[model samples]
Target chain A: MIKATNLTKQYDNGFVAVDSLNLQVNKGDIYGFLGPNGAGKTTTIRMLNGLIEPSDGSVTIEEKEVKSENALVSKLIGVLPESHGYYNWMTGREYLKLFAELYGVDKKRIKSRVEEVLEWVGMAGKADILIGQYSRGMRQRIGIAKTIVHEPSIIFLDEPTLGLDPQGQKDIQSIITRLNQEQNVTVFITSHLLKEISEICNRVAIVKQGKLLEEGYLDELIKGYRLVLRNENPTLEDIFFSLTTDEVGGSI
Target chain B: MSSLIKKEIREHVFSRKGVWIFFAISILFSGLTYSFISVKELSLLAQVEVNMTFMKALIGISILVSIILGSTMVSGEREQGTLESLLLTPLSKVKIILSKVVGILVFWLIISVISIPYFYALTYGTNMLLTILSYLYLIGLPLVISFSLLSLAFSTWISSSKNATLLSIVLFLVTAIPMFLSTTMKKSGFAHLVDLLSPVSASMLTLKDWLVNRLGFFFIFMDSLPVLCFLAISIICLFYASKKMDFLGGE
Candidate 1:
């Protein structure tokens, strides 16, 4: 579980990336964070993951402070950065094993765990190939595999499906679904694909200009939006455009 | 921590570039040693002086290699987009910096090992091997490590590896100014001040005292104090820079 209170990040140039934002991600929930470009989504993720210090307020993971380098907080959460990079020299299996060791997986279990995560992300067959030679989809799968190598309770995936083909996108979406439904792992994913989020995420939060526009259960939010628009059926894309657009009347 | 160190070594020191660097240094020492013993005019110098020259060249090359290694350690990771994942792990920033320092140490060790045969080849008939090795480990190691640490601190603060390396090279050349001064310029007040303050000069002075001048241990230790102080300052600067070490790298 994660909680952020009055979180704010303002650059010295007087630009606020995230302004007094608050968010809560419960255990075992697939929470999709949606925002347009430069909407402060990645900044919020970085702050929550403790990769960067917030200019104001704080974040706590399972009641532990997230700002400092707390091993417990690190153990509880895994993160896949938006522009994730890999060591081209390392094979997929070696990469996972290295992360497993860094995450403090038991020495005896590291081998099995690496294999298991490789299999989980559907990278077992290509596990021994150098990352440099792999396709983008394969690299993305390995990236996901690295995050769960140590069995973190929660994983933050920033644009996991970016730059992937339709099949690759589907593969990643299924992996997210399996992780949440079968393994009961919490997923906090960010993306521009509202349709994909609608398919997999049970809860969603939409933000624009560093401020939260909407936050609630997907179905409840949709139902509320449908009533407001006087329409019986409306897609998440419609709701996303409605909330994020600056027009007096939303495009929907 | 060991995993981080191993990763650092594999990524930086155990790669193709690392192998080439080692190979080139080996060839350089071989040629230098052969020229020292066989060249008619050069071979006329005393064996101790030859040994001293070899040691100086070894330390100079070692300092350059260490600087290159340190200058890219952090910024290289940032450029490659690997620093964030490493930071996300439980490893503290200080430990990350320490792991990189260890990687540079491993590089210095390899350079030290490669110079051994050359040292033996030149100091074959004399008791200079022990003295040369002493200077290598004592004055050379500390000075080389200090330069690398100072560069590592620069790498932590600078985002671009190219810029960090360039800045570190400038610093290296500045400290090496005393080495390039003429005998007359060496006696000038400014040169004297730089020689006393610069760690490179201090280490060189310490080595000359022990090897050529054959000064007492107390005098050598006093000469080496500036080098030790430089090492301490570099260590402090590196850790202080590590406190502000971020995923973005630059200030």
Candidate 2:
């Protein structure tokens, strides 16, 4: 579970990235955070994930504040940033092992944990190969493997399906579902793809220009948005259109 | 912290560039030692007199390698987009910075270990080997740590590793220039400061004392204050960079 209260970020140049935005992600739910380019989505995520400090307000995960001593908060969370970078000189297994150590996984169990995560991400076969030799999809899977190597309870995945083929996207989506259903891990995902959110996320929050426009369970969001529209069966895209503006970051 | 240090050490050890640099220096050291010892007109004791020169060479090479690693560590991580992943981890900045310091020193330690036999042969039948060992700890350790921290400051402050490297080279010259100019400048506060706080200058002074004047252990410790001064300044710089500079690194 996570909570953000009046969370805001402002730059020295008088630009506001996230402006007093409030958000909540429930336990074990696939929560989708939808926004367009520079919509302050990534900035909000960065604040929540403890990469940057917010100018105001606060975020807490599992009752722990993400800003103060979030390194401790990081112990319970795994993150796959939008532009995940792998150590190209390292083997997939080696990379997993390195993160395993960073996450304070026991040295004795590192080998098993590395293997298990690699297997979970379907990278076990290529675990011995250098990441530089891996395909983009393979690298993405290995990135996910490293993210969850310590079995964190909450996983934040940014644009998990970006640049992937249909099959690769399906495979990643399946893994997301498995993590939610089988492992009972909270999935916080961000994406521009409305269809992907509709297919996977149980709850959704739509934001534009760092401001939250709408948030609720997918069914409730659809029902609420449908009341304003004639479409009986509202798609996520339809709900998004009804709730948020087309204007992006600069105008706001 | 140990894991991070080990990871960094493994990277350097496995790198082809590191291997070539280490051995190339070693081969050059061997050639220099053999040539000096093989001079028919020079006595074995006279050959051992070059101990200070060989020790200087080792210190210089070690600092060079350590600075390269330290100056690139943060910027390289940022460039590869791995810095966020690292900053997101549970490790503190102190732990990260200290581990990098230890990592670079460990690499230098390995390189220094490989030079021991060559140095021992060069100093056979003299008190020079003992001098080398003493200076290696007193002079070598602090000197390398100072350079490593200074380079780390550059790495944290500069987003581009190339620029960090350039700045480190410039810094190297900045520290060395005062000593060079002091020969012409009178004993001003500036010249006195360089005399007190420049390791390169102290090194030249110490070696001169050993060869021409009688340099005792007391004088050696006193002359090495520059090493301690640089080490203290480097500590301040490291602390500042860790707390104030952006971990994401930038231009």
User: Which candidate number would show the highest DockQ if scored against the true structure?
Assistant: 1
Q: In model 1, where do residues sit more than 4 Å from their true spots?
A: A248-252
Tens-place lDDT digits, model 1, residues B181-227: 98788888989888779888888888888988999999999999999
Instruction: Identify the runs in model 2 with alpha carbons over 4 angstroms from their true place.
Output: A242-252, B37-49, B178-182, B185-196, B210-212, B245-247
lDDT, candidate 2, at B75: 83
Task: Note the residue pairs that clash in candidate 2.
Answer: none
| Candidate 1 Cα deviation (angstroms), residue B48 | 1.5
For each candidate in the order shown, give its overall lDDT on alpha carbons: 0.90, 0.82
Which lDDT tens digits does candidate 1 get at residues A93-137?
Answer: 999999999889999999999989988999899999999999999
Docking class of 1: high
lDDT of 2 by residue, A1-252 (tens): 899999999988989999999888989899999986777888888899888889999999999999775878999999999987878988988888889999999889999989888878898899999999998889889988878898899999999889999899988989889889999999999987898899999999888888887889999878876668888898998777756654572323
